[model samples]
Target chain A: MKLKQLFKLVLINIYHNKMRTFLTTLGVIVGTATIFLVVAIGKGGEAQVNEQYSKLNVGTIIIMPAQRGKVIDPLTKKDAELFQKSKNIAAAFPILNGSGDIKYNNYSDKSSYLGIMPQYQEASNLNLLGGRFLTEEDEKKKARNAVVGFELANVLTDGSPEDILEKTIDINRRKFEVVGVLKRMGDSGSRQSVDDSAFIPYSSAERYLLGTRANPVINAQATGLETVKGAIQDITNILNENHRLGGAEQFRIMDAGSRLASAQETARTMSLLLLSVAVVVLVVSGIGIMNVMFVTVKERTKEIGTLKAIGAKKKEILGQFLAESVVISLVGGILGVILGFANLPVLKYFQLPALPSLSGVLLGLFFSVTTGIFFGFYPAWQAAELNPIDALRYE
Target chain B: MGKESKCIIDARNIVKIYQNGAEELKVLDDVSVKVMKNDFIAILGPSGSGKSTLMNVLGCLDLPTSGQYFLDGIDILTAKEDQLAEIRNKKIGFVFQKFNLLPRLNAVQNVMLPLLYRGVEEEEAVRIAKEKLKMLGLGDRLNHRPNELSGGQQQRVAIARAIVGNPPLILADEPTGNLDSKSSMEAIKIFKELNQARNTIVLITHDTEVAEQMKRVVYIKDGRLFQN
Candidate 1:
């Protein structure tokens, strides 16, 4: 039989039984939609991770005291100074993390602050929107100056960056000049959002805000991407010798690449889990298709017999039934792609990241069609193999 | 018929048995029959007399347990299933008691089925089907589905479908069983007309009245055959 005519026959049958066709393809629709959405969300997560990491210097590494037994000398300013002189390390600074209530005129809000040296600006890839960042003179003189984050500057003063810069803000009852307003970089990969924090000289933070009792972490930048390993090695040796640690490791070293890797791994794991769920749904939907095809063949037994008597070969019979199933799934797949696209706005409403991709849509369609073929074959074969005598005799 | 008249159906010592596990029930026993070209014959039997089984075997729908059967000079016993399908497509037209029109298809589409299966172009099939339906007094009902037609109209449509391909033989099993008396007479008239037009026909039924109208009658009783 001509394929087009055969398809028309299948279509006529499917069209007449609208409810059955809709119900049979429902599972496939949901399955493929899920597949598409899962892929989009996975891509969104990867893009998010990449964007976060891209905001920071690639050679930046964080060294913190690996909390085990206390009383081992914590990383100090002297240790940071030693790292700055090391051949592999290009720049190093001790970071003192603290939160304080800031008062700018009548507006007051609690914000976290990072205390670091002037070199920390380049190491952290901080971009200024107005004025200049902290200088060597400011660190050496222990001047009370702060470079506010984009959001912090908005909160402390007028929304304008130029207005926020050079404005004085009260931090823990001490006045500090806002020398610069940093550009917005959103949430960092390794820490809290940089947009909500302020940067100040480490000398002033140690002497005035956080006292000598607070432990400080050292942030360092390698001379080049290739020197990161050597930089980490130099940091460990310096901290071990300076702190007088014998055999046990005291500090934990983390590089930007490793952090990016772990984030990517998390994204990949989530994608795999969702893909499995989509597969399960597809399998269950496939079984549904198989079940419906069986019922259809049974119900059309006399019709099958009639067609056989009229000269339809077994393969023609098989093709008609199989094509019916494939068309059902193909329709479902197309609807699923539309549904997936439709869900993008809902995800956005919930503030979830999702990036629609062509590959995801293709994969979803491929899965649905494969499911149809895999589950549709046996039932079609059964219809083709039916005895014409019994079939025609069937009530 | 003359000695030169070719046999359309020639069966010798045909036997059909139905097996249920270890128990076996014989449906046909040593039944032999011959049908010459353009012959009109009826095999008459009551229920359980295996008349339907004989129709099935003769239609090449089921294989006999032991038999040498030839359909239009082609060996039915040795022909493969696909070969039987092809032969049935090109040589046999079947009209059933139920009419058996596919409900989803319109009259024309249903009538075009055999030709479609024979790989006829759809346009040609449709055109031929329309002409056949017109000749069968179904011209106004070309697009009507089976349910939309009366039993007689549905039967006419089935006859149109059966003869649309102009096959050599028409096998009808209780073709008038589902029709009213008036429709049954009309169906019988059409079959006689077809037979007179040089198309071979074998009608299976238990109704003596229906069988009496045929040119030849064969009686089947409890899997055995007798002719008068």
Candidate 2:
């Protein structure tokens, strides 16, 4: 039979049994929709992580002490100086962080305090939203000056930083003038509030706050992130040499870039797992279509016999049934794409995270159509192979 | 019929056996018949006399158990199932007692079914179907479905479907069995017209009146051919 006639026949058959066709196509629709939704969730999670990662300096690396059960790094000034003089290391600064109370004339509040070097601003990509950052001269002169975080500055003073730059605040029973206030970094990849902190010169912190404490934890930045591994290795070797461990492990080094890469790899694996599950659902849906087609062939036995007696070839009969199945699945798949795309805003409304990609939609459609063809073939073949004599004799 | 004339159908020493469980029951035995082009013949038989079984074999719908059956010089008993079906489609047409019109299709579409299966163009197929229906006196009922038409009109539609493809041989298996006498006579009148128009027809019927309407009659009793 001509393809057009076959198409018309399929349409007429479906139209004759609208409810059955709709129910059969519903399985395919739900399967496809589930796949698209799962993939969107995975994509959404990855995109969220990437957006968070983009806010920081890509070339910066965090070096935390890796000693067992020890949260603080115990490096001395000599070690910090050695790292600052290493090749390809533009700048390095030791950071000694602690929580303390800041008292400013009945406006006392508790916040984190960090003792950082002058170059810490350049290394950490810290933007100062108020006054200037710590200076090398302030460190050399051991000036009791401090730069407050944006939130800390607001809590300590009633007006802007200019109105409170010369104000003195007592820390550990010592009075320090806030010469400058650092800007709020908003939130870090660690998801902690960085705006509620105070910055002071590293030397003064070592002399007064820490009381001759050894080198604290430090953060450094590289000119190029591609060389971050090499930079970390270089820093590790220098620290080992300076600590007199005779090339043995003395200080631990950690690379944030490598950590981020590992996180992304984990996300990719999760996405793949989700997609595989979706494919399984689609395969099951295909089997359902095949089963329904078989039932349809049995129901239309007389019809098949009539067409065969009228000169329709086996291939023509097969094409007619296959066309019916394919039309059902393809139509279901198209509606699935629409449903999947429509789910994006719904997810956004619930704030559940969903990234609907065009590639995912196309992939779902391709699978649904292929499922129809693959599953429809066997039933169609069975219908075509039916003997006209037996079929006509069948009630 | 003269030996020189082409016999549209010739069956000799035909036999058909049905296997039910272990016992083999013979349905037809040593049946022989000949029909020439344009001859209107009737096979008269009672129930279970194998008239319908013989019709199935002659229509290329079933293979005889052991026999020689030829249709238009082709060995129908030896032809493949698909080939037999093609011969039936292109050279023979059938009108069943129940009319057997697809309930979903209207009169015109019902008549166009065989041509559509033969891959005829839609416009030409529709034109021929309309013309045949008109000729069958169903012109005004072209858009009516089977349920909407009267018993006689439905049979006329079936007859139109049978002859629209212009097949040389037409088979009617109790074509008037379901109709009233008046309607049956009307259907017979159409069959007479088709026969006079040079269309060979083989009609199976038990009604003496129906058989008398044909030019010749062959009788079958207990699966064996007999003289009427």
Candidate 3:
């Protein structure tokens, strides 16, 4: 039979039972919508992380003290010395971290203070706006030199990076000379901005503030991208040897690449799990299509006999039923794509990533259509194999 | 009738048996009949007389359990189910007692169905269907659906569909069964007119008067056929 005629017949049947077609297609719609929406969210989050990490160095690795309840000694001068001597390591800075209220003349606010050596200004990619950074002699004599981030400069000097230099700031009730101000990066309108942080000499911080603190972290730099893996091995081996650790778990070398890779893997597994749930919903929807088709065949028994008697072959009848299901799925899938795309705004409003692409639309349609065909087969076959005589006799 | 006329329907010792769970019923017992082109005949029987079963076999909607049957000289007893459909499309047209006009399709579209199944172009099928409906005095009702037409008009629409393709044989099961007496006579008159136009028609009915009006009547009773 001609495809046009078959389509016409299928159209008439669908028109005859509008509600059944809609009801059968609803499950697929929900499944497609859920899957596409979740994937978009996952993509958006990954994009956000990538944008944030782009400014920093990929060769930078952050090593914090272990949380294994063994009182893993804080990274100290001795540890920094070991790092400077380690192979594949170009620079190392032991970060003494503290958070306290700072008073600069009449301006006072809470700030994060990171104490490091003068090499940390270059090794940690700290871009300064003006003035000199902390020097090695300052750390030896324990001079209270301070460098403020853009957020701190804005608070203390009314947003002028240069005005904050040569000023005095009291940190945790101790006076410090403002030596420099860090450049602005990822600080505007974000709570997790590094621009709000303060920096002082590591020896000075250990002498007067945050003495014998636990969970101290160290920031290490590799020579270049090429020696990153070797640098990581050296850090792990050197830290293990200096701290007399037996296991590799005492200090982790969390590099930019490994961090991003782990985040991506976690997102992938989470989205896949959600997608599987959507697939399960789609499978149930497929069963719904099959059940509806079975009922449709039974209800149209006399109509099937009429068609067969009027010269329609078995295959033609089968084609008509199968086409009906495919049409249902196609409509549902299109609606699902629209629904998912429309929900992207809601995802974005919540600060989530919404990366709904054209490929996602195509995949949604493909899955829905395949589901229709695969589940509609047995019912279509049953319609084709029906005995015309018995069908005609059915009341 | 001898070989002077071309035989369109020939059944020799046709048998049809239905299998119940524990019992087998013989629906058509050695039924045999012969029909030629332009023949207007009726298979007259009471309820349970196996006339419908014989109609199914002769219509090629079924195969005989044990017998030789030929439709338009194609040995249907050996034909595959799909092949029977091909023969039915080209050689046979069927009209049911219920009129069986697809309620969704209007008059012209209903008559175009048989041709459409044969892959006829849409425009040509519609043109041919329109002409046939016009011939049946349904020119103004071409766009009227089955539900919009009266019982007689629906039956006429069904008759138009059956003969629109100009098949060699038309098998109608109680074509006037749902019509009033006046509509019944009108339907029978149309059949007579079709016969005059060289259309072979087989009417199945229990009405004796309907049987008497036909050129020949084959009476079926107790799963057997008797020529009358």
Candidate 4:
């Protein structure tokens, strides 16, 4: 028979029993939807991690003093000078981190403190919500000024950045002037609480906070990510020469780029794991389709016999059943894609994060059609192989 | 008939055996018959008398265990299943007792099925099917499904389907078995008209009255043919 006539027959057959067709396609719908949702969620996590990683300067290397064995201490001015003298090191900043109690009028709270050189703001990529960041002149003059985080300033004074400027805050019994306020960084899994910290000049921190400590932790910036390893080696050699340490027993260097890479790798592994689970669901659903098709073949035996008696070729019979299976799966796949796409806006309406993309929809369609072809073949073949006499004899 | 005239079917020593465990039961034993073109012939018998088996073999629906059966001078007993289907499509049309019209198709669509199977274009198939239905006095029932039509109207639709492809031979197995007397007479009149119009037909029936309506009658008993 011509394919057009065969298609018309299949359509009429399916239309004759609409409820059974829909129920049989439901398995494909659920399977495809699961695949799309899982892929979208995986992409969502990847985007989140990539966004967090982008916040840091790529190829930046952090150098600090080694303590006990391999632990690094906060950066100090002496270490910064030693790194600056090295050839491969492009830029360096001495950093000191500590938690101290601050009191402004009757509002007293404990907040994180970061003491760093003026160049640290440029290297750290900090966004300023109000006032200005610390200047080079301010660092050179050993100015006892600080930049307050947005949340920290809110806790300290009941005013804006203009109102809180030059306000005195007692940090460990030493008073410092607030120069600027940093912007609000959104909440994520990263451990750094940029919202609750105060920034100060490194020189003043060394005088007041470091006391008799020899070396402080440092944040070093490289020209590019490719040069970060070389910069770390250069800084390590300089630090060893300055501190008079022996070979292989001196200081440790931490690369923020490597940490970001490991974080991305973990995210990729998790996404793959979730996708595997979704694949299992798709396979089980394919098996369900095969089972339903087998039942359909059994139920339609008399119909097949009648068709054969009317001079339909075996291939024509096979084509009809295969067309029915494909129609069921394709319809289900389309519905699943729509459902998956619709989920994004619904999630956004509820303020929940969701990622839906074209690739996910394509994957769902590919798997659904493949499942149809895979599961629809055997039953169609069996129907085609049916003996006309026996099938006609069947009640 | 002249020697140049075609004999639509010719069979010799046709035998069919069914295996039940170790015992083989014969369904058709050494039956030989010939049907000429445009002749209306009927095979009459009671239940289990092997008439249906003879019809099946004549319709090319089953191959005899041992026999030489020729349809349109082609040895159908040696033909493949697909080839047999092709021959059935091009040479024979069948009408079943149960009005085996597809419930989903309208009268016109069901009539168009054989032509469509023969690879006729849709427009031509529809035109031919409409002409056949109109000839069968079913012009008003073209769009009605099988369940929507009366018993006689449905049988007329089945007749239209059988004759629409213009196959040389028509096989009707108890064509009026499910209809009332009036409807059965109407079906029989249509069959007589078709046979008079030069269409070869084979009718299988247990009713002697139905068998007498045909020009020639053959009786079978206990899987063997009886000369009458």
Best by DockQ: 1
Docking class for candidate 2: acceptable
Candidate ranking under lDDT, highest first, comes to 1, 3, 4, 2
Instruction: Give the whole-model CA lDDT for all candidates, comma-separated.
Output: 0.90, 0.81, 0.85, 0.82
Give the alpha carbon lDDT tens digit for every residue of A114-217 in model 4. Answer: 87788888776788887789988778887889888777787878555446677888787789988888887765445557777888887777778756553556
In model 1 chain A, where is the ten-residue run with the lowest total lDDT? Answer: A239-248
lDDT tens per residue, model 1, A1-395: 99999999989989988898888889999999999999999999988888977776778888887883363577788878899898998888899888879878888779888888888887678899888999999999999999988888787675765587778988888899989889987777545667888888999888889886557888888888899999988888887678765421777888887888888899899889999999999999999999999999999999999999989899999999999999889888998899999999998899677999999999999999999999999999999999988888889
How would you class the docking of model 3?
medium
Ranking by DockQ: 1, 3, 4, 2
Candidate 1 lDDT over residue span B30-59, tens digit each: 999999998999999999999989998999
Fnat of each candidate: 0.95, 0.51, 0.73, 0.56
Q: Candidate 2 — which pairs collide?
A: A75-A215, A76-A215
Candidate 3 lDDT over A1-395, as tens digits, reads 68987888788878888988889889999888877886776776667667756755777777875664455455566766777676677777787778899888788888888888888877656788888788999999999899888888898776566787898889999999999888886632234466888889988998878876634677777778788898888887777776764444666668877777777787788788888988998899999999999998898888888889999899998998999888888888888888888888888788666798776788788888988899988999899899998888787
Alpha-carbon deviation at B154 in model 2, angstroms: 3.6
lDDT of 1: 0.90
Question: Which stretches in model 3 have alpha-carbon errors above 4 Å?
Answer: A45-58, A67-72, A100-113, A116-191, A195-216, A223-253, A349-351, B1-4, B21-24
Model 3 Cα shift for residue B189 (angstroms): 2.2
TM-score of 3: 0.86
Q: What is the lDDT of residue B65 in candidate 1?
A: 99
